[model samples]
Target: MNKLIDGFLRFKKNVFPQKRALFRDLAGAQSPTALFITCADSRVVPDLITQSQPGDLFICRTVGNQIPPHGSAPEGGVASSIEYAVHALGVQHVIVCGHSDCGAMNAVLHPERLKDLPSTNAWLKNAAAARSVVLENYVGLVDDVLLHLLAEENIVAQIENLKTHPAVAARLARGELQLHGWFYHIHSGDITTYDAQAGRFAPLDHGSATATPPRRIYHFSAGDAA
Candidate 1:
């Protein structure tokens, strides 16, 4: 905790003064560009990765980055945030990012581990589609590779769930929003975005945009990826 306190002090004394004007402007309100949703992994810092300022992105972090499909839960906290970001903040984009070796994905692949974590077990059912998708398509795969694919697929599944929200559906219908699926490779510090046309997670490039409400689901095999 001392480290965090010291960092705050440094920010107040040095960094705060440097960006005082920007802070003053943001004091009353904030208009972020994107709604970035990712796992609650301490290592994945959205600001650090995207080089964003304080008001650049509105972030939502969940255990598995799970987003329950609309109507599955009534006015859930996650859905409330999605509504706020879309209706109130008018964010242009929503990115569902999942990382390598995700604990939630691990539990999904290994159900026995969840015997003691009943609440988590139920919560992860929101992402149950991911496990099924992998099982149906990627036969004979197991261990780390299977888990890796599960993480990637979970991001895709959650993004689909995100679209089910009334706010997101309305905005998408009006062409006012874009949704993204991202896989962040923790060990390598690399980000691969799902390309709806290509139907695979490839290195994200500034030249291209993530598919908006993809008609087809993106899938990958261990050998098929370059």
Candidate 2:
């Protein structure tokens, strides 16, 4: 922990002074541009990868970058954060980022390894659909390739789960929100974004927007109210 403390001291003495005005403006309130949801892996630093300032991105991290579908657990941390970011904070973008060589993904691929981690295994059920997609569809692939496919599919799964949130669904209906799925290569420091048109993850281009396909809006029919 000394390293963290020393880093904080350096920030306070040097970086803090440099960005004093920015912090001052953000002291009373914050208006971040996006809601970044990613794996809780140390290597996937959201701000560092995005090069965003303190008040730029509101982040939520979870193992495997999983997002439980809405109503599965309404009071859950991820659900609450999504609601606050969209309804309260008015963030326009919600990103689900997964990384290469993710330990959580590896665990998903090998469930036997998680027998001691009951809670973790339970939580990873959120990615079960992704696991099924990868295993059933991508046959004959090597272990490493399968792991990578699981990570990518998990990101896509989480994005679909994000839409189930009431806040996200409502905003999406109005064409006000955009969803993005990202894969970050830990070793190479490369990022690829899901391209709806291409139906694949493509290299991220600076100054360009990479968004998920249009979401299906839920219509509440009057007859169903009976």
Candidate 3:
């Protein structure tokens, strides 16, 4: 952990001093504008990717970026965070981001490989609909292409799952909130966002705003939702 301590030391001596005023203002209260839900992958740094500063985004990181459906359990960590970010923090936007070369997605695509990882396998059940979408429809494709498709589909799946939450649903119905699906191409640092009108994920070009539909309505079979 020397590397982390050294990084913190550098931040304390250099970065924190420069942003002292910003931190002071944030010390009292925070009014973040967005709730960023992403994978617990070290490579996908949300703040760095969005160029957001402290107090700008409320973040929730989960394995595979999976969000359990509302009421699936009485109490859940992800659910609580989602409720607070939407109902309490009043975040206007909710972004579910997935990335290429995701280990969690890999395990979702191949449950056989997760036999030894019972907890991980159980956690990824939230991503089952995405896996079903790819396996049932994108038959015959394999390797990187299949992996890429699954990642995108997983983002879409999770966004749908987001709608089931009461806080998110209420805001959406009143036109007070927006949901976005993002795919981060790690190697190129290129980001693609879901475009409801075009029915595909297109490059999230700089200086452009893409507001995803509350639900893009992917055709996941009934069994998949289980």
Candidate 4:
């Protein structure tokens, strides 16, 4: 843990001092613009990827970036965070981001491997739909290709799950919020966004803006599955 303590020391002595005024202003209150939901993977840093400053993105990191669909549970942690971000913090956008080499998705794709971690197995049930969707649609894919597709499909599935939240639905109804699905390529630091218009994901050349998308999350119909 010395490494972590040293890192904090640097943050306090260097980074924090550099942004002291920003931190001082933010100490009183924060009005972040978006709720950034991503995986617990250490490789994917939201602030680093987006170049966002403190008080910009209220982050929720989960294993596999799993978000239970609304009404599935009475009071899920993800649900509470969503409500707080949308209704209380007034975050204008919600992003469900998945990354390559996701251990959570890897385990989901091979449930047999999670035999020892009962809790992790249970938590990932929130993403079981993505697994089913992939098995039915991506019949022959394997290895890295399978994992990559799983990560992408998981992002799409979680975004749909995010929409099931009542607060999210209400905000969208009033045209106050937008939801986005993102696939972050870890090795290259490239991000691809869901092209709601094309019914697929497209490479975000630089970045994307927060606006009401013309379309929403894509779910594979029975026929669409392999």
Candidate 2, residues 1-226, lDDT tens digits: the string is 9999999999999999999999999999999999999999999999999999999999999999999998884329999899999999999899899999999999999999999999999999998999999999999999999999999989988888988899998998877788988999999999999875676888888644556544656667999889
lDDT string for model 4 (77-117, tens) is: 88889999999999988988999999999999899999999
Off by more than 4 A, model 2: 206-209, 213-226
Q: Write down the lDDT of every candidate, Cα atoms only.
A: 0.87, 0.91, 0.90, 0.86
Show the colliding residue pairs in model 3: none
On a 0 to 100 scale, what is the lDDT of residue 14 in model 1?
A: 90
- The sequence of per-residue lDDT tens digits that candidate 3 reaches over residues 30-102 is 9999999999999999999999999999999999999999998532999999999999999999999999999
Give one clash count per candidate, in the order shown. 0, 0, 0, 2
* TM-score (C-alpha) between model 2 and the true structure: 0.92
Q: Estimate the overall C-alpha local distance difference test score of candidate 4.
A: 0.86
Q: Which has the better TM-score: candidate 3, or candidate 4?
A: 3
What TM-score goes with each of the models? 0.91, 0.92, 0.91, 0.89
Residue 65, candidate 4: Cα error in Å is 0.5
Error of 4 at 49 (Å): 0.6
